[model samples]
Target: MIRKTMTVLALAASLGAAVGFGALPAFAQTAKATVDAGKAAGTVGEQADGFLAVVSGGDAAQRAAVVEINTGRAAVYKDTAAKTGVTAEAAGQATAKQLYARLAPGQYWKPLDGGWAKK
Candidate 1:
Protein backbone atom coordinates (compact mmCIF):
# COMPACT_ATOMS: atom_id res chain seq x y z
CA MET A 1 0.00 0.00 0.00
CA ILE A 2 2.80 2.41 0.89
CA ARG A 3 4.65 1.73 -2.38
CA LYS A 4 1.44 2.14 -4.36
CA THR A 5 0.70 5.47 -2.69
CA MET A 6 4.24 6.74 -3.41
CA THR A 7 3.91 5.80 -7.05
CA VAL A 8 0.59 7.58 -7.33
CA LEU A 9 1.98 10.70 -5.72
CA ALA A 10 4.92 10.72 -8.07
CA LEU A 11 2.63 10.32 -11.05
CA ALA A 12 0.44 13.18 -9.90
CA ALA A 13 3.47 15.41 -9.44
CA SER A 14 4.73 14.60 -12.90
CA LEU A 15 1.32 15.25 -14.39
CA GLY A 16 1.10 18.60 -12.66
CA ALA A 17 4.45 19.61 -14.03
CA ALA A 18 3.51 18.40 -17.48
CA VAL A 19 0.35 20.44 -17.36
CA GLY A 20 2.30 23.43 -16.05
CA PHE A 21 0.75 24.35 -12.73
CA GLY A 22 2.55 27.68 -12.82
CA ALA A 23 1.27 28.54 -16.26
CA LEU A 24 -1.12 31.44 -16.81
CA PRO A 25 -4.78 30.73 -16.17
CA ALA A 26 -7.03 29.61 -19.01
CA PHE A 27 -8.92 32.91 -18.94
CA ALA A 28 -5.68 34.83 -19.29
CA GLN A 29 -4.61 32.72 -22.23
CA THR A 30 -7.99 33.16 -23.86
CA ALA A 31 -7.80 36.88 -23.25
CA LYS A 32 -4.48 37.09 -25.03
CA ALA A 33 -5.87 35.34 -28.05
CA THR A 34 -8.92 37.59 -28.13
CA VAL A 35 -6.82 40.68 -27.68
CA ASP A 36 -4.68 39.67 -30.64
CA ALA A 37 -7.78 39.24 -32.74
CA GLY A 38 -9.26 42.55 -31.61
CA LYS A 39 -6.03 44.35 -32.37
CA ALA A 40 -5.90 42.89 -35.83
CA ALA A 41 -9.50 43.89 -36.46
CA GLY A 42 -9.03 47.36 -34.97
CA THR A 43 -11.92 46.91 -32.61
CA VAL A 44 -9.85 47.09 -29.45
CA GLY A 45 -6.90 49.18 -28.37
CA GLU A 46 -4.62 49.71 -25.42
CA GLN A 47 -5.85 52.44 -23.12
CA ALA A 48 -3.97 54.95 -20.98
CA ASP A 49 -5.37 53.25 -17.92
CA GLY A 50 -3.30 50.11 -18.51
CA PHE A 51 -6.40 48.30 -19.67
CA LEU A 52 -7.81 47.45 -23.06
CA ALA A 53 -10.42 49.67 -24.62
CA VAL A 54 -12.97 48.88 -27.25
CA VAL A 55 -12.29 51.47 -29.89
CA SER A 56 -15.25 50.07 -31.73
CA GLY A 57 -17.88 47.49 -30.89
CA GLY A 58 -16.75 43.92 -30.41
CA ASP A 59 -18.39 40.56 -29.86
CA ALA A 60 -19.22 39.12 -26.46
CA ALA A 61 -16.12 36.97 -26.41
CA GLN A 62 -13.87 39.95 -27.08
CA ARG A 63 -15.45 41.95 -24.28
CA ALA A 64 -15.00 39.06 -21.89
CA ALA A 65 -11.38 38.72 -22.91
CA VAL A 66 -10.77 42.38 -22.27
CA VAL A 67 -12.36 42.07 -18.87
CA GLU A 68 -10.09 39.20 -17.92
CA ILE A 69 -6.96 40.96 -19.12
CA ASN A 70 -7.92 44.18 -17.41
CA THR A 71 -8.59 42.39 -14.15
CA GLY A 72 -5.14 40.84 -14.26
CA ARG A 73 -3.57 44.21 -15.07
CA ALA A 74 -5.40 45.85 -12.19
CA ALA A 75 -4.09 43.28 -9.77
CA VAL A 76 -0.56 43.76 -10.99
CA TYR A 77 -0.84 47.51 -10.71
CA LYS A 78 -2.17 47.31 -7.18
CA ASP A 79 0.60 44.96 -6.11
CA THR A 80 3.28 47.16 -7.63
CA ALA A 81 1.79 50.24 -6.05
CA ALA A 82 1.92 48.62 -2.64
CA LYS A 83 5.58 47.80 -3.07
CA THR A 84 6.58 51.13 -4.62
CA GLY A 85 4.66 53.46 -2.29
CA VAL A 86 2.47 54.84 -5.05
CA THR A 87 -1.20 54.71 -5.84
CA ALA A 88 -2.59 51.93 -7.97
CA GLU A 89 -3.68 54.43 -10.60
CA ALA A 90 -0.15 55.79 -10.82
CA ALA A 91 1.32 52.37 -11.28
CA GLY A 92 -1.26 51.53 -13.88
CA GLN A 93 -0.54 54.70 -15.84
CA ALA A 94 3.19 54.00 -15.72
CA THR A 95 2.66 50.51 -17.04
CA ALA A 96 0.35 51.88 -19.71
CA LYS A 97 3.13 54.08 -21.03
CA GLN A 98 5.50 51.15 -21.28
CA LEU A 99 2.95 48.92 -22.97
CA TYR A 100 1.87 51.72 -25.32
CA ALA A 101 5.41 52.17 -26.52
CA ARG A 102 5.62 48.47 -27.33
CA LEU A 103 2.54 48.50 -29.53
CA ALA A 104 2.96 47.34 -33.10
CA PRO A 105 3.08 49.97 -35.86
CA GLY A 106 -0.50 49.44 -36.95
CA GLN A 107 -1.96 48.75 -33.54
CA TYR A 108 -4.49 51.10 -31.99
CA TRP A 109 -3.94 53.04 -28.78
CA LYS A 110 -6.14 55.31 -26.67
CA PRO A 111 -4.28 58.35 -25.48
CA LEU A 112 -5.15 60.57 -22.52
CA ASP A 113 -7.17 62.82 -24.78
CA GLY A 114 -9.79 60.06 -24.98
CA GLY A 115 -9.56 58.98 -28.60
CA TRP A 116 -8.06 56.05 -30.41
CA ALA A 117 -5.08 56.42 -32.73
CA LYS A 118 -3.13 53.93 -34.75
CA LYS A 119 0.47 53.61 -33.70
Candidate 2:
Protein backbone atom coordinates (compact mmCIF):
# COMPACT_ATOMS: atom_id res chain seq x y z
CA MET A 1 0.00 0.00 0.00
CA ILE A 2 2.78 2.38 0.90
CA ARG A 3 4.65 1.67 -2.28
CA LYS A 4 1.56 2.12 -4.39
CA THR A 5 0.75 5.38 -2.69
CA MET A 6 4.28 6.63 -3.22
CA THR A 7 4.10 5.73 -6.87
CA VAL A 8 0.89 7.62 -7.26
CA LEU A 9 2.33 10.57 -5.45
CA ALA A 10 5.39 10.56 -7.65
CA LEU A 11 3.27 10.59 -10.77
CA ALA A 12 1.07 13.29 -9.39
CA ALA A 13 4.08 15.38 -8.43
CA SER A 14 5.49 15.09 -11.90
CA LEU A 15 2.22 16.13 -13.44
CA GLY A 16 1.86 19.05 -11.06
CA ALA A 17 5.38 20.28 -11.61
CA ALA A 18 5.06 19.97 -15.32
CA VAL A 19 1.69 21.63 -15.68
CA GLY A 20 -0.28 22.37 -12.52
CA PHE A 21 2.01 24.83 -10.74
CA GLY A 22 3.54 26.02 -13.97
CA ALA A 23 0.20 27.26 -15.15
CA LEU A 24 -1.62 29.32 -12.60
CA PRO A 25 -5.26 30.14 -13.01
CA ALA A 26 -6.20 33.64 -14.05
CA PHE A 27 -7.29 34.55 -10.53
CA ALA A 28 -4.07 33.26 -9.05
CA GLN A 29 -2.04 35.19 -11.58
CA THR A 30 -3.69 38.39 -10.46
CA ALA A 31 -2.57 37.76 -6.91
CA LYS A 32 0.83 36.35 -7.83
CA ALA A 33 2.57 39.65 -7.54
CA THR A 34 1.38 40.19 -4.01
CA VAL A 35 2.39 36.72 -2.95
CA ASP A 36 5.73 37.04 -4.66
CA ALA A 37 6.41 40.32 -2.91
CA GLY A 38 5.36 38.86 0.38
CA LYS A 39 7.70 35.95 -0.15
CA ALA A 40 10.58 38.26 -0.97
CA ALA A 41 9.83 40.29 2.13
CA GLY A 42 9.80 37.20 4.31
CA THR A 43 6.18 37.63 5.26
CA VAL A 44 4.85 34.75 3.20
CA GLY A 45 6.03 31.23 2.60
CA GLU A 46 4.83 28.17 0.80
CA GLN A 47 3.52 25.42 3.03
CA ALA A 48 3.86 21.69 2.59
CA ASP A 49 0.24 21.33 1.62
CA GLY A 50 0.51 23.38 -1.57
CA PHE A 51 -0.70 26.65 -0.14
CA LEU A 52 0.83 30.02 0.65
CA ALA A 53 1.20 30.90 4.30
CA VAL A 54 1.96 34.04 6.20
CA VAL A 55 5.04 33.40 8.19
CA SER A 56 4.89 36.58 10.24
CA GLY A 57 3.93 40.21 10.25
CA GLY A 58 1.61 40.13 7.29
CA ASP A 59 -0.93 42.87 6.82
CA ALA A 60 -4.48 42.58 5.60
CA ALA A 61 -3.58 42.89 1.96
CA GLN A 62 -1.06 40.13 2.22
CA ARG A 63 -3.54 37.97 4.08
CA ALA A 64 -6.11 38.57 1.41
CA ALA A 65 -3.62 37.71 -1.28
CA VAL A 66 -2.89 34.47 0.48
CA VAL A 67 -6.54 33.63 0.51
CA GLU A 68 -6.90 34.34 -3.15
CA ILE A 69 -3.87 32.33 -4.10
CA ASN A 70 -4.88 29.42 -1.90
CA THR A 71 -8.36 29.35 -3.29
CA GLY A 72 -7.02 29.14 -6.78
CA ARG A 73 -4.57 26.43 -5.78
CA ALA A 74 -7.30 24.41 -4.14
CA ALA A 75 -9.24 24.45 -7.34
CA VAL A 76 -6.26 23.28 -9.32
CA TYR A 77 -5.42 20.59 -6.80
CA LYS A 78 -8.95 19.28 -6.83
CA ASP A 79 -8.93 19.05 -10.59
CA THR A 80 -5.57 17.38 -10.60
CA ALA A 81 -6.68 14.93 -7.94
CA ALA A 82 -9.73 14.00 -9.93
CA LYS A 83 -7.67 13.39 -13.03
CA THR A 84 -4.92 11.53 -11.19
CA GLY A 85 -7.08 9.42 -8.91
CA VAL A 86 -5.55 10.76 -5.73
CA THR A 87 -7.01 12.76 -2.91
CA ALA A 88 -6.92 16.52 -3.21
CA GLU A 89 -4.63 16.67 -0.20
CA ALA A 90 -2.28 14.22 -1.83
CA ALA A 91 -2.27 16.21 -5.02
CA GLY A 92 -1.46 19.37 -3.10
CA GLN A 93 1.38 17.71 -1.25
CA ALA A 94 2.77 16.51 -4.56
CA THR A 95 2.62 20.02 -5.92
CA ALA A 96 4.18 21.29 -2.73
CA LYS A 97 7.24 19.18 -3.37
CA GLN A 98 7.60 20.84 -6.73
CA LEU A 99 7.14 24.29 -5.24
CA TYR A 100 9.71 23.58 -2.56
CA ALA A 101 12.24 22.66 -5.20
CA ARG A 102 11.77 26.07 -6.78
CA LEU A 103 12.12 28.08 -3.59
CA ALA A 104 14.71 30.82 -3.63
CA PRO A 105 17.31 31.40 -1.01
CA GLY A 106 16.16 33.39 2.04
CA GLN A 107 12.65 32.08 1.60
CA TYR A 108 10.83 30.18 4.30
CA TRP A 109 8.85 26.96 4.10
CA LYS A 110 7.07 24.77 6.58
CA PRO A 111 7.12 20.99 6.44
CA LEU A 112 4.07 18.98 7.21
CA ASP A 113 5.27 18.12 10.71
CA GLY A 114 7.66 20.93 11.52
CA GLY A 115 8.03 24.64 12.09
CA TRP A 116 9.06 27.07 9.41
CA ALA A 117 12.59 26.97 8.06
CA LYS A 118 14.56 29.23 5.82
CA LYS A 119 16.08 28.03 2.60
Candidate 3:
Protein backbone atom coordinates (compact mmCIF):
# COMPACT_ATOMS: atom_id res chain seq x y z
CA MET A 1 0.00 0.00 0.00
CA ILE A 2 2.79 2.40 0.85
CA ARG A 3 4.55 1.69 -2.42
CA LYS A 4 1.43 2.31 -4.38
CA THR A 5 0.82 5.56 -2.56
CA MET A 6 4.33 6.74 -3.25
CA THR A 7 4.03 5.91 -6.91
CA VAL A 8 0.80 7.81 -7.21
CA LEU A 9 2.30 10.79 -5.44
CA ALA A 10 5.23 10.80 -7.80
CA LEU A 11 2.94 10.67 -10.79
CA ALA A 12 0.89 13.49 -9.32
CA ALA A 13 3.99 15.61 -9.00
CA SER A 14 4.93 14.98 -12.60
CA LEU A 15 1.44 15.70 -13.86
CA GLY A 16 1.28 18.86 -11.79
CA ALA A 17 4.50 20.08 -13.32
CA ALA A 18 3.21 19.49 -16.80
CA VAL A 19 -0.03 21.34 -16.09
CA GLY A 20 1.67 24.18 -14.24
CA PHE A 21 3.94 24.75 -17.18
CA GLY A 22 1.07 25.61 -19.50
CA ALA A 23 0.87 22.23 -21.17
CA LEU A 24 -2.91 22.39 -21.52
CA PRO A 25 -4.30 22.95 -24.99
CA ALA A 26 -5.15 26.42 -26.19
CA PHE A 27 -8.88 25.79 -25.92
CA ALA A 28 -8.54 24.92 -22.27
CA GLN A 29 -6.51 28.01 -21.62
CA THR A 30 -9.13 30.10 -23.33
CA ALA A 31 -11.85 28.62 -21.15
CA LYS A 32 -9.91 28.92 -17.91
CA ALA A 33 -11.20 32.37 -17.08
CA THR A 34 -14.79 31.24 -17.38
CA VAL A 35 -14.09 28.16 -15.32
CA ASP A 36 -12.46 30.25 -12.65
CA ALA A 37 -15.47 32.46 -12.54
CA GLY A 38 -17.71 29.46 -12.23
CA LYS A 39 -15.65 28.09 -9.39
CA ALA A 40 -15.84 31.36 -7.54
CA ALA A 41 -19.55 31.37 -8.05
CA GLY A 42 -19.88 27.81 -6.76
CA THR A 43 -21.26 26.67 -10.08
CA VAL A 44 -18.26 24.59 -11.07
CA GLY A 45 -15.92 22.29 -9.24
CA GLU A 46 -13.10 19.87 -9.85
CA GLN A 47 -13.91 16.19 -9.80
CA ALA A 48 -11.78 13.34 -8.50
CA ASP A 49 -11.42 12.17 -12.09
CA GLY A 50 -9.23 15.15 -12.97
CA PHE A 51 -11.94 17.04 -14.76
CA LEU A 52 -14.24 19.93 -14.01
CA ALA A 53 -17.87 19.43 -13.06
CA VAL A 54 -20.87 21.62 -12.73
CA VAL A 55 -21.86 21.43 -9.13
CA SER A 56 -24.96 23.50 -9.51
CA GLY A 57 -27.16 24.04 -12.47
CA GLY A 58 -24.78 26.31 -14.27
CA ASP A 59 -25.48 28.40 -17.29
CA ALA A 60 -24.64 27.25 -20.76
CA ALA A 61 -21.41 29.18 -20.76
CA GLN A 62 -20.15 27.54 -17.60
CA ARG A 63 -21.04 24.09 -18.85
CA ALA A 64 -19.32 24.79 -22.13
CA ALA A 65 -16.20 25.93 -20.31
CA VAL A 66 -16.15 22.74 -18.27
CA VAL A 67 -16.45 20.65 -21.40
CA GLU A 68 -13.62 22.51 -23.08
CA ILE A 69 -11.32 22.25 -20.08
CA ASN A 70 -12.09 18.57 -19.55
CA THR A 71 -11.37 17.77 -23.19
CA GLY A 72 -7.91 19.25 -22.86
CA ARG A 73 -7.33 17.46 -19.60
CA ALA A 74 -8.31 14.17 -21.19
CA ALA A 75 -5.73 14.67 -23.92
CA VAL A 76 -3.03 15.59 -21.43
CA TYR A 77 -3.80 12.61 -19.23
CA LYS A 78 -3.65 10.26 -22.20
CA ASP A 79 -0.30 11.64 -23.28
CA THR A 80 1.09 11.46 -19.76
CA ALA A 81 -0.16 7.93 -19.32
CA ALA A 82 1.60 6.84 -22.49
CA LYS A 83 4.82 8.52 -21.48
CA THR A 84 4.77 7.07 -17.97
CA GLY A 85 3.47 3.63 -18.88
CA VAL A 86 0.35 3.99 -16.80
CA THR A 87 -3.31 3.90 -17.72
CA ALA A 88 -4.95 7.19 -18.58
CA GLU A 89 -7.43 6.84 -15.71
CA ALA A 90 -4.55 6.34 -13.30
CA ALA A 91 -2.81 9.41 -14.64
CA GLY A 92 -5.98 11.44 -14.23
CA GLN A 93 -6.64 10.30 -10.67
CA ALA A 94 -3.05 11.10 -9.78
CA THR A 95 -3.40 14.54 -11.27
CA ALA A 96 -6.61 15.02 -9.30
CA LYS A 97 -4.64 14.85 -6.08
CA GLN A 98 -2.53 17.79 -7.16
CA LEU A 99 -5.60 19.67 -8.27
CA TYR A 100 -7.39 19.17 -4.97
CA ALA A 101 -4.42 20.53 -3.12
CA ARG A 102 -4.65 23.78 -5.05
CA LEU A 103 -8.30 24.45 -4.41
CA ALA A 104 -9.00 27.82 -2.86
CA PRO A 105 -11.18 28.23 0.18
CA GLY A 106 -14.91 27.92 -0.51
CA GLN A 107 -14.41 26.33 -3.90
CA TYR A 108 -16.43 23.19 -4.42
CA TRP A 109 -14.91 19.81 -5.25
CA LYS A 110 -16.04 16.22 -5.42
CA PRO A 111 -14.26 13.06 -4.40
CA LEU A 112 -14.55 9.81 -6.25
CA ASP A 113 -16.74 8.20 -3.58
CA GLY A 114 -18.54 11.24 -2.27
CA GLY A 115 -20.65 14.22 -3.13
CA TRP A 116 -19.45 17.77 -3.65
CA ALA A 117 -18.10 19.80 -0.75
CA LYS A 118 -16.56 23.13 -0.16
CA LYS A 119 -12.80 23.37 0.11
Candidate 4:
Protein backbone atom coordinates (compact mmCIF):
# COMPACT_ATOMS: atom_id res chain seq x y z
CA MET A 1 0.00 0.00 0.00
CA ILE A 2 2.77 2.42 0.86
CA ARG A 3 4.66 1.66 -2.33
CA LYS A 4 1.57 2.08 -4.47
CA THR A 5 0.76 5.38 -2.88
CA MET A 6 4.30 6.61 -3.31
CA THR A 7 4.27 5.65 -6.97
CA VAL A 8 1.04 7.49 -7.56
CA LEU A 9 2.25 10.55 -5.74
CA ALA A 10 5.49 10.56 -7.72
CA LEU A 11 3.65 10.41 -11.01
CA ALA A 12 1.32 13.17 -9.91
CA ALA A 13 4.20 15.36 -8.87
CA SER A 14 5.96 14.85 -12.18
CA LEU A 15 2.88 15.74 -14.20
CA GLY A 16 1.90 18.58 -11.93
CA ALA A 17 5.42 19.89 -11.83
CA ALA A 18 5.37 20.20 -15.59
CA VAL A 19 2.12 22.10 -16.05
CA GLY A 20 -0.09 22.17 -13.00
CA PHE A 21 1.13 23.31 -9.59
CA GLY A 22 3.79 25.65 -11.02
CA ALA A 23 5.42 25.97 -7.64
CA LEU A 24 8.77 26.56 -9.25
CA PRO A 25 7.63 29.24 -11.66
CA ALA A 26 5.00 30.83 -9.51
CA PHE A 27 7.12 31.41 -6.41
CA ALA A 28 9.32 34.45 -6.47
CA GLN A 29 13.05 33.85 -6.03
CA THR A 30 13.22 35.48 -2.65
CA ALA A 31 10.11 33.79 -1.39
CA LYS A 32 11.31 30.49 -2.71
CA ALA A 33 14.59 30.88 -0.91
CA THR A 34 12.80 31.78 2.27
CA VAL A 35 10.57 28.74 1.98
CA ASP A 36 13.56 26.52 1.24
CA ALA A 37 15.38 27.73 4.27
CA GLY A 38 12.32 27.39 6.40
CA LYS A 39 11.77 23.84 5.30
CA ALA A 40 15.38 22.93 5.87
CA ALA A 41 15.28 24.48 9.31
CA GLY A 42 12.02 22.80 10.26
CA THR A 43 10.39 26.15 10.76
CA VAL A 44 7.84 25.52 8.00
CA GLY A 45 6.21 22.48 6.52
CA GLU A 46 4.17 21.51 3.53
CA GLN A 47 0.62 21.03 4.67
CA ALA A 48 -1.71 18.29 3.46
CA ASP A 49 -4.23 21.01 2.58
CA GLY A 50 -1.99 22.33 -0.19
CA PHE A 51 -0.58 25.24 1.70
CA LEU A 52 2.58 26.05 3.60
CA ALA A 53 2.45 26.39 7.34
CA VAL A 54 4.80 27.37 10.09
CA VAL A 55 5.83 24.39 12.13
CA SER A 56 7.77 26.70 14.37
CA GLY A 57 7.24 30.40 14.70
CA GLY A 58 9.15 32.50 12.25
CA ASP A 59 9.62 36.15 11.51
CA ALA A 60 7.12 38.23 9.57
CA ALA A 61 9.21 37.76 6.47
CA GLN A 62 8.79 34.02 6.62
CA ARG A 63 5.05 34.36 7.07
CA ALA A 64 4.94 36.70 4.10
CA ALA A 65 6.74 34.14 1.98
CA VAL A 66 4.15 31.55 2.86
CA VAL A 67 1.41 33.95 1.83
CA GLU A 68 3.09 34.66 -1.47
CA ILE A 69 3.53 30.98 -2.31
CA ASN A 70 0.00 30.15 -1.26
CA THR A 71 -1.44 32.87 -3.45
CA GLY A 72 0.20 31.36 -6.49
CA ARG A 73 -0.94 27.89 -5.47
CA ALA A 74 -4.49 29.17 -5.07
CA ALA A 75 -4.60 30.51 -8.61
CA VAL A 76 -3.18 27.30 -9.98
CA TYR A 77 -5.64 25.21 -8.02
CA LYS A 78 -8.57 27.27 -9.25
CA ASP A 79 -7.48 26.99 -12.87
CA THR A 80 -6.82 23.29 -12.62
CA ALA A 81 -10.10 22.63 -10.86
CA ALA A 82 -11.98 24.48 -13.58
CA LYS A 83 -10.30 22.53 -16.33
CA THR A 84 -10.73 19.19 -14.58
CA GLY A 85 -14.29 19.69 -13.35
CA VAL A 86 -13.31 19.53 -9.71
CA THR A 87 -13.49 21.94 -6.82
CA ALA A 88 -10.50 24.12 -6.05
CA GLU A 89 -10.13 22.44 -2.70
CA ALA A 90 -10.08 19.04 -4.35
CA ALA A 91 -7.48 20.12 -6.84
CA GLY A 92 -5.42 21.68 -4.11
CA GLN A 93 -5.62 18.56 -2.02
CA ALA A 94 -4.46 16.44 -4.91
CA THR A 95 -1.63 18.82 -5.61
CA ALA A 96 -0.71 18.83 -1.95
CA LYS A 97 -0.35 15.08 -1.96
CA GLN A 98 1.86 15.34 -4.99
CA LEU A 99 3.97 18.13 -3.54
CA TYR A 100 4.36 16.35 -0.24
CA ALA A 101 6.28 13.59 -1.91
CA ARG A 102 8.60 16.10 -3.44
CA LEU A 103 9.88 17.26 -0.11
CA ALA A 104 13.51 16.33 0.47
CA PRO A 105 14.78 14.39 3.43
CA GLY A 106 14.80 16.46 6.64
CA GLN A 107 12.10 18.71 5.24
CA TYR A 108 8.79 18.68 7.06
CA TRP A 109 5.48 17.45 5.67
CA LYS A 110 1.97 17.15 7.03
CA PRO A 111 0.92 13.77 5.78
CA LEU A 112 -2.56 12.47 5.08
CA ASP A 113 -2.38 10.95 8.54
CA GLY A 114 -2.83 14.49 9.84
CA GLY A 115 0.54 14.74 11.51
CA TRP A 116 3.81 16.41 10.66
CA ALA A 117 6.90 14.33 9.99
CA LYS A 118 10.25 14.83 8.42
CA LYS A 119 10.40 13.46 4.92
Q: Using TM-score, give the best candidate's number.
A: 3
| TM-score, one value per model | 0.76, 0.81, 0.83, 0.76
Ranked by lDDT, the better of candidates 3 and 4 is 3
Local accuracy of candidate 3 as per-residue lDDT tens digits, 1-119: 45655665687877775653355567666578889889899999998988899999899988998888787778878887777677788888889988989989999989999999999
lDDT of 4 by residue, 46-95 (tens): 98778888888888989999888788778877776565556666666777
Cα-based lDDT for every prediction: 0.69, 0.80, 0.82, 0.73
lDDT for each residue of candidate 1 in 1-119, tens digit (9 for 90 to 100): 45533443334333222222236777567778888889889998998877787889999999988887777777766666565566667666666666676678888998777678899
lDDT of 2 by residue, 31-89 (tens): 77788899999999999998889999998989999998787778877787677667888
Clash pairs, candidate 2, are none
**Model 3 error, position 83 (Å):** 1.3
RMSD of each: 13.7, 2.7, 2.5, 5.1
Model 3 off-target regions past 4 Å?
A: 1-8, 17-27
Of candidates 4 and 1, the better by lDDT: 4
Best prediction by lDDT = 3
